[model samples]
Target: MAEAARGLGWHPFPGPAAVNSVRYQNRAACAYHGFCDRGGCHLDAKNSTAVSTIPRAQETGRLQVVTEAHVRRVEVDGEGRATGVSYLKGGEEYFQPADVVLLASYTYENVRLMLLSKSPAYPDGLSNNGGQVGRHYMTHATGAGVLALFPHRLNRWYGLPAQGVAIDDWAADNFDHSDLDFIGGGNLWVYSDRRPIAAARMPTFGRAPRWGSAWKAFVADNADRWTNCYIQKSTLPYEDNYLDLHPTVTDPLGDPVCRITADFKDNERRIATFVQDRMVEWFRAAGAVEIIRQGLGTMGPSTHAYGGTRMGDDPETNVVDRWGFSHEAPNLGILGASVMGTSGSHNPTLTAQALGWRTAAHLVENWSSIAG
Candidate 1:
């Protein structure tokens, strides 16, 4: 695994191949935290796999991609060797043969696929010998700190949310932990830009009625004046929380959808309250006359899902080795956020991409050792 490089690190000089311009435009004002509000990144400004390696993979004729194909099971040979995968495509089933099958599906889907592909020799399920298929899940703890009612117009509605600023003074090991109740920290974010559709649903702060003339008047007066403070806090995995095949629900093709069962721990609760209070203080410092701080409530589905088949050296603890290779299935490899052992104070997309590249390179360089 590569050491996580931070934005705080030294500036990266533009290489000869770098395109020094904003490539995409996303004007959608309503995202996870109001970032990328421009409908979507129209210019493909964001560097996701959709713009990167997937294209390169396609260029290599050795690789075949079945876009709409939903893999139902991993077909194994007589001696416990992975041979191929059975999948559904347009109301029909098909099998694609491959010497080694790599499960690159997203976190939950990766685990579900393994459990779904049960065999006689691996009756308990491939790699489920110890029953550690879906465990140790982590989702970021999130809540908003809002401040409304100002004496003047702040001109709060424009610009990308994260494009404004992020103060990581409290994030990770950046601060001292002498008297803190929790070990982790948060990033303080403040930005303005809310579309009418989003502004209409702003938290009322217990002042205006849900409907009527008063609501209209309230919107008229404060639509462009409110400031939202976001605190992206850390979340740690607990023993009781995990993902598993749902007992009762299945998808359109008769496969189980992943079910999440998690409860935030006391450490997270402490972090949320502490961070909210800090955010409120920052809003006050920024000239907020009235601030409303909301604490972390019950956990919900997260965009940043991590940890299922975590990577580590010990098979007792993790499903994948440090190189993202499965310990049980020598030829199988795993990718995406599910293999992350720890969730840092950063987004996982770039990190996951880097890890995927590292894993693929390893397989290329040491193919004989891995495939033997």
Candidate 2:
């Protein structure tokens, strides 16, 4: 890992190790733009769209990426065909005509833009006449695992959030849930020491006195003693949980922000509970003196969030076709995790990238069929 960083002309943090896994908490540690970890990667070392596909797409002069281009709506012709996009580029309003208008933005953002783009052809919103634009928003149900103390120092502070080993014995189809009450399961992981700023946020278990001597002692004794266990549970889509336009709030460019409303169902709770118990067992086997298993918290904006514009064979049930093409607006293509029908146990990045490449390929092959 150090050699890889050095090859990229990025210096690793001091006291680097060959391998380490830190807790990521399923946060947007790296979002679409850059590394969103404890602090933004100043040198942009994290592999994100800004460093990867966006550049390749730019290399082709045919592909134009308008940064700070907030698309307000998808313009459609009289026959209900997508012709172009109306957007704000550098505080100036402009309309760019395209043979096809692809929605390659993030999941929630895609739905939000669709809802805000109301037209006579799409009275409710663009490509949303079925009211299914924001219908199936979902994120995995994951809880943190806590480790008390071990005999030796693992020195876990100097590794990427996902560089360590993961135990996927219980993830997705790997486990038999026949006798269990839930339909899904999670992957258990034991990561390296939690960072200082992140570690301070822990409960302290009421063991550390808040004031002087005891607090200092607690901090000194347990700073590097903790480990992180995370469970990446499967999330099923439901009718009630979804994303929609937030009428109350809008971005700087006058576009509505996406609002999420969802709660963990019984199935998710069961999976979370089962994984927490297993994590405790693993920590015990790893010689943890004490463990603080995290309880399931309220669902919110998840990095692995998916399923606002689903892909399927049926037009009534799904927005995009299997190839991620809009059924109503033939020329428009929707990319990213939003088209996924099921949330795989792993992170969505690799899958999204795979799908992106696949979608781009399909476009290249069937260019006339889709673009016409």
The TM-scores, one per candidate, come to: 0.85, 0.85
Error of 2 at 288 (Å): 0.4
Best by lDDT: 2
Candidate 1: residue 4 Cα off by (Å): 28
Range of the 10 consecutive residues with the lowest summed lDDT in candidate 1: 11-20
Q: Can you write out model 1's per-residue Cα lDDT over 175-276, one digit (the tens) per residue?
A: 888988787877665554455667666665666886899988877877776767556777776656788889999998777889998887788788778777
**For candidate 1, what is the TM-score?**
0.85
Residue 53: error of model 1 in Å? 3.0
For every candidate, C-alpha RMSD to the true structure in Å: 6.0, 7.5
Candidate 2 residue lDDT tens string, 43-124: 4445566654577768887667678887888899877788899888877999999897778888988888778877788888
Q: After superposition, how far is residue 166 of candidate 2 from its true place, in Å?
A: 0.8
Misplaced by over 4 Å in model 2 are 1-38, 142-144, 200-207, 252-255
lDDT of 2: 0.72
Pairs of colliding residues, candidate 2:
21-192, 29-36
How big is the RMSD of model 2? 7.5
Q: Residue 123 deviation, candidate 1, in Å? A: 2.4
